[model samples]
Target: MASFQIIIIGTGIAGLATAISLSQKTQHQILILESSSVLTEAGAGIQCSAAASRVLSSWALREEFEAVATCPDFTEIRRYEDDELIGLIPANVNDYSTRLRGFPHWLVHRVDYQKILADAATTRGVKIDFGQKVVAIDVDNVEVTLASGRSLRADLIIGADGIHSRTRRSIPALKDVVPRRTENYCYRALIPREEMLKNPVTATLIDNQSQQAWAGQFKHIISYPIAKGKFYNLVMTVPDHGDAPLGQYNEPGDVSEMRQVFKDFNETVQAVLDTIDSCAKWVLADLPPLPTWSSPNGRVILVGDACHAMAPHAASGAATSLEDAEVLGLCIATCNGIADLPRAAKDYEHLRRPRCERIQEISRENATTFALPDGPMQEARDQIWRAQKAMLEKQLQEDTPLAIPAEDMAQQFPHPALVQWLVGHDIIEEARTHLATRKEIHNIL
Candidate 1:
């Protein structure tokens, strides 16, 4: 293997994770560019399923992550109007060894998780330059021009910039790839655990350390505890009626308006909303599946939200980004020199694109299923949930595994098989297998 210069744009989860993973797998000189002068404390809570958690564990971040993250015991789904229990999924149970791939499902604050990755990457000899916004990308020359008119050349460039990626726009081949607004907006707020505990209705949530979701007509709410359970994170997604401006992705939300939208929700949800002093409204948008994730020469490539930004309905945005970082690193490690960079980039895209595209589709489907109005379809969905709940309860009481028909399982929200496939996937092993097969083919040829 030969050493090369690698530049990763942005310092979000994808950028930082790529830096760390590449540092561990390859001998390349890695640099991360951040547009912000300082690491801003933005974003709300994020879920880290076993798929991403396994990658973090490989990077030796488990202890630090566990210290700041909350492992919810289970997840509960309920009706919006009367708080009728619809379904229950065990998230972090001892007996259910296969749950979450035997790794704890982490509910963590985004800021804390990013800091951990940043620190780990720095410790591994990766350098991050702040306030170095990428203004343009020269795919042919394998270089980037910063906003300050500084040109930096590298052997390869990874565009982890984000949804409004300048790097993606710089590539002529990706001109057709654009983000489309989903007409869905989310109001995010955090309530203090102490405040919640003061109210008995909300105290149960804090005590259980469980994730809760309320499904309603054209809207839904999901809440979980983060920051070591000291703060509770709330996300309310509803139809977007020009709440935020076209260009603005995130802005201050009106508390009164947020409360009114979910005012008809059950008492517990209302209590949670009432505890919020302020909230931020964010517009939901997603990109169509791109024809390619790399330039013609493959010196430049996209990762994370830069190429595959999806609706947050599935709560797998960050996890998928982490998977991208891991898979990219593993693929790049197979390259012997600069000439092999193109093949490595192609392999990264081949392994990642289908999975990401499928997840994107699932996220969009969830947005509809989670907010069904009172209708026959809504009733049918609720009936599936009720059946699933009964089956889960029966399994607990009988202490035995009951064979569930694949079709029956498919009907449940969050689809058990889908959850397992999402969280239990070993990206590392798959990358290794892919590389091994490619090597054998090359030898035979």
Candidate 2:
């Protein structure tokens, strides 16, 4: 009998979710490797849309997630120059249990979410090894060599490393694939909740429990509350003027430099900026859609950002990875032994590629729209948002049949649709159906 041993690279959301989901269906010894001496995630916020929530909830993480995440009631968009309200997209979770089958939209800190996933995975018997950098991989043989020259073998190897994944290069068939800089650098900051609440200017902003985005010439900023309102997460994306291959992904940034970038922004935005003491900076990079994410033997495969590194505009970067983890985990569950893994891996690629690629394209488009300069095109985009906002308010008034005042209309606008294509997808059920058909075909053969 083949050994049901699995080795996963990285300890991020993708790796942990994969281990947890796979352990649910079968008893397998899973090992996760991390290169860092200490496990830490960047200080930033991540939005978990309804679709991702469904996947996590299925894993029995709903209660834990709700404890640390804030379910925003609405997300507002404004012009950076004058703070003109252009759109107010209400959360689809407004009716909680009715829409998306009770799935929620969550805003959480990256570090907190990582800990939750890691804790869940460990409770299921998944072993995690820190300070172990994988230096080489034999895809066909399902073997990995660490920097220390120690060799380990498994029935399967999953590459869950991020955009600059070394595991991605280990596939012998891929030689030209590399992460390309998008010329966009992201600056991140975390504001202490107590200090923010103490200031009258910042207190009202966070009191409403909403996610806000401000768009400007060639840049944008998104801010929201995480850790049950313990901290405010802020991310600002601007065009990078520095040379490529900075030799590192993250660097220290000064608060004064960041403030100057948005010096012309509205008073509210400026007020929030003054509170930031320091920021972390990183250039956003993504890889082109690879022809395949599996090795020739199919015993080794790539998941998450390792294969579909996308711009963060669509807010689907981590969510898509969760979808991948859920589906790939289900597909692997169909494997009766190591011999069946190749077919399962092939099926995973077949089902995942199209969906992930579409999201990748959408992310780029969203980024382009969000970063448009002050021009006719930007004006047109703003006009569309205004029209949608008006229509949504009208619908809200009609549905409620109440004489709402104009001042209250801002809070009464009907919820707008999120990326409809991604919001309600049932990836788990789809994977199960795919596996059922595969079994049928095998029986007939």
The TM-score of predicted model 2 comes to 0.92
Query: Candidate 2's residue-wise lDDT over 292-320, tens digit each?
Result: 89887878889999999998877888898
- For candidate 1, give the lDDT: 0.84
- Please report, in order, the local distance difference test score of every candidate based on alpha carbons: 0.84, 0.80
Against the hidden reference, what TM-scores do the models get? 0.95, 0.92
Off by over 4 Å in 1: 41-43, 95-100, 401-412, 440-445
Q: Where in model 2 is the C-alpha error above 4 Å?
A: 1-3, 96-101, 244-247, 398-418, 440-445
Model 2 per-residue lDDT at 242: 69
- For residue 132, model 1's alpha carbon misses the true position, in angstroms, by 0.9
Error of 1 at 80 (Å): 0.4
